[model samples]
Target: MTDARDPIVRIEGVTKAFGSFTALHEMNLSIASGEFVTFLGPSGCGKSTTLRILGGFETPNTGRVILDGQDVTALPPNKRNVNMVFQDYALFPNMTVRRNIAFGLELKGMGKAAIAARISELASFLELTAYLDRRPDQLSGGQRQRVALARALAPDPALLLLDEPLGALDAKLRGQVQVELKAIQRRTNKTFFFVTHDQEEALTMSDRIVVMNKGRIEQDGTPEDLYFRPASRFVAEFIGETNLLTGQAIGRDQDVTGFDWQGNRLRAIASPGVGATATTASLRPERVQVAQERPGTDNAVQGRVVNRLFKGHRMLLDVAVGNTVIQAYTDTDRGRAIEDGPVWLGWNANSLTLLAD
Candidate 1:
């Protein structure tokens, strides 16, 4: 959450190129104070490049980097009021956790009593009171991560930059820390610029997510918006599991669109600027309903059950509709209707979305 005050950071018309390869193309972004924004994309998608440019680690070829209304594009990393937490949690193995957290405060010429007080505050806040005397090598991976985060926060920078800080932990630990990090951000009310290739992580922690592909931004929206209403094929495919149906447009009626897919006439909700000739539709598995008889719905098709994957409470079924396979999910007990034979799949027209790509 953030106040209505102006954005704390802004990147305008930024582009970065190395030799013949372009990393970022006309990157533009604005982040308000206390807003947890995530830069999510695959490798070489310019997410990290954008982060480095904002943190003053790399200079942008053309554009302005404004931090709290002051341009800092040409300033060095240390000169800017920003701190980055590296993926490896670059902590000093030889120093105790208290000393490590106090390193930045010491560099800023803080008094002994003030530095000690600040260390005490961070130690209690990060739940590292008992481990204050332990070195980085003596602490657990999660503790080391917290120590690194505490050290970065000790400086009290205007913005915090995190580059996949949780990549080193195990799956369970990573999931647990994601919640903790989000809680910390809300409590501290500090603007965070995080970069990661993990979709689930981005969805779990961000107030807003910027989806990037190749060398540009694809979509910027809330987690639910990007997951439920993707703007392009790349965003629809990258955000989560989806079934893409490609066909020619048959007709359009306001929001609903009729299309021909593998000789079957299906209808879906069309996006803005969807052409009348050919297009693609995206459908989520959980929205597809499979039954023994065709339900009276706007869209229905017959298919043979080819595969079923059970996951305790729910199950995923792969129904072969002619040559194309459409996947659906149902409750374990309700899934018995399409065990292994021909079945009818039906879904509301509003559930399916016509993609721009």
Candidate 2:
């Protein structure tokens, strides 16, 4: 029996390059069984390259690929217990959903009876029972995506690599599929190695996200951990919208640091890797509360509303405080912040996360 706690996949010292340009550095990461991990980054950030390496489409210049405790660096895609679902799904045009799913099983030399049973099981599991006999052309984008997933999962691979599987769907369908994919991963308990540049997709579907940049892993942690407690400036800005405040540290008390931003005294908790003399912090727009009356918080600042954008339930206000402009997203009914209107921005000390220079 496989222990779910043990790392089923481990990429150790993996490095890949094309000619003089190196793509992946000495990357090392371990993924536990049944965990959903996402390689999230922009284009040319080595996320796709890393996924290709795992699927045997690209060979690493140096490193070992471990699958289920065995070093499979030399193994081909077929030899390794790994399957990939691509952006286009790559489903066969001539075959029905049944044959498409059974293709991998038949390649494994499974009997007809076993393949049929597996197909039935997966069709029901993926809600494709009604479309099992349809060809790829007859199905919708979401249906085709499900078919591709069923086909990939039919092999019962130890790991599934999804390369932007929802990229083909429309915006609304993409969001819907994100939730479905996450639910399917949870239901199947299959370890997923997902690669996508869509931050929202990564945030919504991943149990953990590995933020990559410049051919290297920038930050690796849970969604909340990376979003709320980023370890670096790259992570703070990449994961979501943030206000990178440049300030001077005047003093410290425990984990909290007294910060001076445009002469506004603010208190923020310092994160690891933040030097004592560092002058930067990451504050989310939603953390800034706007009101006419000054909030009784440890940190407060006065500003004039320079711009306001109505976004359904909330409003985004650009407030100008002296020479600095701070963006704050508050409830639509919180207070009226019109252009050139005086507004008070307040937040607790814990809202600011100090960034390391």
Candidate 3:
């Protein structure tokens, strides 16, 4: 088992470029021995590039990659104790399930008994003992993914890198395999660095997440921290569905500020460094509460319901305030059932977050 006290991988000031187009900037990060960290972002955002560098598939133009306290920046793929599970599963067409799982051991020149023992251990963990002789073509999508995972684990690498491992599976199969993947990770306790563009998958599987944008690290924290407290405008909008109300800053103090959205004035309880200029109020749709009549509060706005959508147990309302629209989620049985009429929207003072211009 890997030591839990030490960081298994340390990447410092890593930069990669292809001609004039830079894929990764001088990014610095650390992954603990058994920690499951995910790199989340949109396409061409350098998340895959960073993973490639860590796997020794691509060399960085600047800075160093330190694995297990040793600088392995110049090491080739064969020398590094890291294995990757590709998006396609990348199983050999002619190889049976047993051969695919034992291929890595054969490359390392292990005895037949040793290879068999390792494959048996992995098959039991992944519940693939019955399908040991089946080929990739004969197994289902979920079974193929498990075989890929078992192959990666057969070599016992210090770190396992997954590059969109579930992208090929259908929605229902993805959910089922996701549970299996998490269970396997917990049982092995191997450091995992997963790269994916799916936010829901990242939030559900990762212990911590690193959000990237334009080849730069936007934010890095626990899933709860990123969901609740985003560091920038891009992060707040990218991480989840949020209601962003842009307005001119009308009032300010050391600890509080106010902004004007349309003709409506709203109070903001935000950081002490919030400036008086063009700022935004970020709130989740679920945080917004709707009332038939205006509530007597410091932050309430009068608007008309333009449209309503029934989303099973809850309802979504698009409240129109002059030209601006805000989305609010209301329970099916809660407060006034919204019709195409005038209504009031109320959000708590603390929920209004004043973001940088």
Q: Which model scores highest in lDDT?
A: 2
lDDT of 3: 0.87
Global Cα RMSD, each model: 2.0, 1.4, 2.5
Residues 1-357 of candidate 2: C-alpha lDDT, one tens digit per residue: 359999999899999999999999999999999999999998999999999999988899999999998888888899999999999999999999999999999999999999999999999999999988899999999899999999999989999999998988999999998999999999999999999999989999999999999899988999998888887888999889998899888888888899999988899987777778878888899889887889898899999988888898988889988888899998886635344588788988888988778
Give me the displacement of residue 200 in model 3, in angstroms.
Answer: 1.6
- Candidate 2 clashing pairs? none
Instruction: Tell me the lDDT of model 3 at 182.
Output: 83
* Higher-ranked by lDDT: 2 or 3: 2
The best-first sequence of candidates by lDDT reads 2, 1, 3
In angstroms, how far off is 300's CA in candidate 3? Answer: 2.6
Q: Scored by CA lDDT, what does every candidate get?
A: 0.89, 0.91, 0.87
Query: Cα deviation in Å at residue 95, candidate 2?
Result: 0.3
For model 1, residues 1-357, the per-residue Cα lDDT tens digits are 225377999899999999999999998889888889999999999999998998888998899999987899999988888998899999988999999999999989999999999999989999999999999999888889899989999989889999999999999999999999999899888889999999999999999999999889898999988887777889889988899888878898877788888988888877655577647888889989898888887899999998999889998999998878999999988876556998999988877777876
The alpha-carbon deviation from the true structure for residue 8 of candidate 1, after best TM-score superposition, in angstroms, is 1.3
Q: What TM-score does each of the candidates earn? A: 0.94, 0.97, 0.91
In model 1, which runs have C-alpha deviations exceeding 4 angstroms? Answer: 1-4, 272-278
